[model samples]
Target: MKITRVYAAVLALTSLLFINCSKGDDDNGGNPPVQETPTIEGTWKVVTNNYFEDSKYFVINEDNTLHIFYEDNLGFKDTQNANYTNNEEELQLTINFGYGSLLANYTVSSDDLVLNFPDGSISLTKETTALAPDNWIKTLKIINEGNAPWTERIDIAWNGSQLVIGNGYEAEAIGLVNPETFALEGTITTSRHAFAVEIENYDDEEKYIFQSDNGSNKFHMYDLADNTHEDESLPLGSWIYGLASIDYQTIWASSNNEDSIYLYDYDSKTIVQTIDLGERSPNGLDYQAGYLYICANGQLYKCDVSDGLEVIESYTLPDYSITGVAYDGSYFWVYAEKNNEGKLVQLDLSI
Candidate 1:
């Protein structure tokens, strides 16, 4: 009887061990842990202290398309489109307004995303709401058009009291233009083609005109008092396209071939800073107040000085190609050829 009772106990213990093993398999072996999918396809916004830069919103779609929207305080809006590709590890963007093809290391959390750029890193947050598109080009209009010298390239600059236009690109003169009527009244014969021109006045006694010839890769200074070329012809080793005065001793020059703008000091004969615009070639340049206006790819861009000279706003026009731009005290002017005739026109910027 004792042997039979021991056998029953052993059989009962084996049955219990089998049941525990099966339950362990069902709980741990048969089922695996679930994982979350990774993604960054959503509308995002960058919050910044700058009033203009803070208004940028980036909308990323699942179809690998990206749209950047900008709106100012006055409700004027603009849009830029580009292609983007994002893996879990990296993000890539095609050509943009200020940057070229860019590859940035990225990290995305539940609602926050950060991208490391070459210059710096930017943080963005996912936005649940999307912005409505209102293109600003629809409101842009030319206020006036007037006769300009027959030249392939035209650059204009505000010379204190009037506008001086350059008949550049193989043409050899700087035409004195009446700002009110936009009429070419007189001309100053130049030894070489004046690709770009800027005027600087320190006092009534100190005034000069700066000129650049395209192939020379150098710029010459002329005293406005005597119209004589000064010995200070600065060479920057790159083709210069545009010139804008920053101060009496400093100026900015743009090289379309190098896609850079150089802040050069004529007195020191040194380059203070070289700003790279990536693939965007700066064709024409003008400085007003604390902002810089640039013409590139037939579009007008306004860059803020407080924000590292980054592009804050852009203006575009249909059926118009801008070769050069200038800002008078009250309005902006551009040199363009419409209907097969080269003309200088005042642009309305109220939008």
Candidate 2:
């Protein structure tokens, strides 16, 4: 009678185990599969181009219209109108002015996107935060170095507390001074013939320095790490009067003669891209926030460098012979030579 009771208990335990296994399989069937997120709609801007150090800052409207603002390396702004359309996988943008439309394949990766053009390509990264207010105020104070006669074209770059000013046309040293008091911090005379056209802090360890002859078509690169300049020089095809470094590896140089902007790769020592601005000679160039601001033929233009190099918006300046341009977070600063005195005008860009 005890052996019979033991067999009956064993059968009961096996029946319970089979029921639990069946319930586990049914639970697995109830789970759902994951789905891909939809592509972002509405207009977008090309805030940065990693391929070409140039930026095309533009806007896309829901109505399929596109606006472009572009500046050559020479500080000339070229404004053009166009239309654009995208189907998530492919994008077709047509610039109505001169050059034909640009067709490319586009891909989205997480929050970042890449557009592959026929000749080259551009990548776009979303902005984490909105830009600060445009409220830049400039106080210009002339400094006299006696008989030395301060460099004609001085490029200014702010480094947190102080501003570094560089002299053009083979100036030996870069001047560091207080932005408010204009007090001299000291001079950096590492390069023997430092044209000091543009100075930019690329990373924690290095700063990029560009210099070119006023008449010649060659530009020099100086690495601030070892305070040494490169042996090889970059050819601009035409005389490079103005330049700006987008990053440590790329530079945008403007040719006054050709009326064009050329993008150069500092790492590989090659010309990667070029934008023809026609007869308008580019004078000064600056990359503010994510837009490439150019002063060309008395106009200001901005481009979306990440969105297939599209021009987005532009405004004509009162003075056509603008010399240089700078953006101090908010306002667009224009330097022009009118009459005998040089004039620095501030333009409001709050809109």
Residues 1-351 of candidate 1: C-alpha lDDT, one tens digit per residue: 999999999999999999989977777745775667646778778754232252477777788777767664423345667777665533544334346666667777768877676666667788887653433333357887776667556567876667787767645688888877766777777886777887773556668888878556678888887889885546663667788787788887888788888778988888878777766677777877777777776667777755346766777765666767787777888876676677777889731
- TM per candidate: 0.62, 0.49
- For model 2, the superposed segments whose C-alpha errors exceed 4 Å read 1-156, 160-166, 169-173, 182-186, 190-196, 231-233, 307-310, 316-321, 329-334, 343-351
| Candidate number of the best TM-score | 1
TM-score of 1: 0.62
Instruction: Give per-residue CA lDDT, model 2, range 1-351, as digits (tens).
Output: 999999999999999998888876777545655568634333234655654333454444566665544444534444445666666544444334346677667776546656677777676654444221111111232222111124343334444454444455534576655544445667666543333256663755667566665556777766655657764457675566667778877777777788887878878888888878766777667676666656565555676665335555655543234555555454555545444344445456622
Which regions of candidate 1 are displaced past 4 Å? Answer: 1-139, 201-205
Per-prediction RMSD in angstroms?
A: 12.9, 16.4
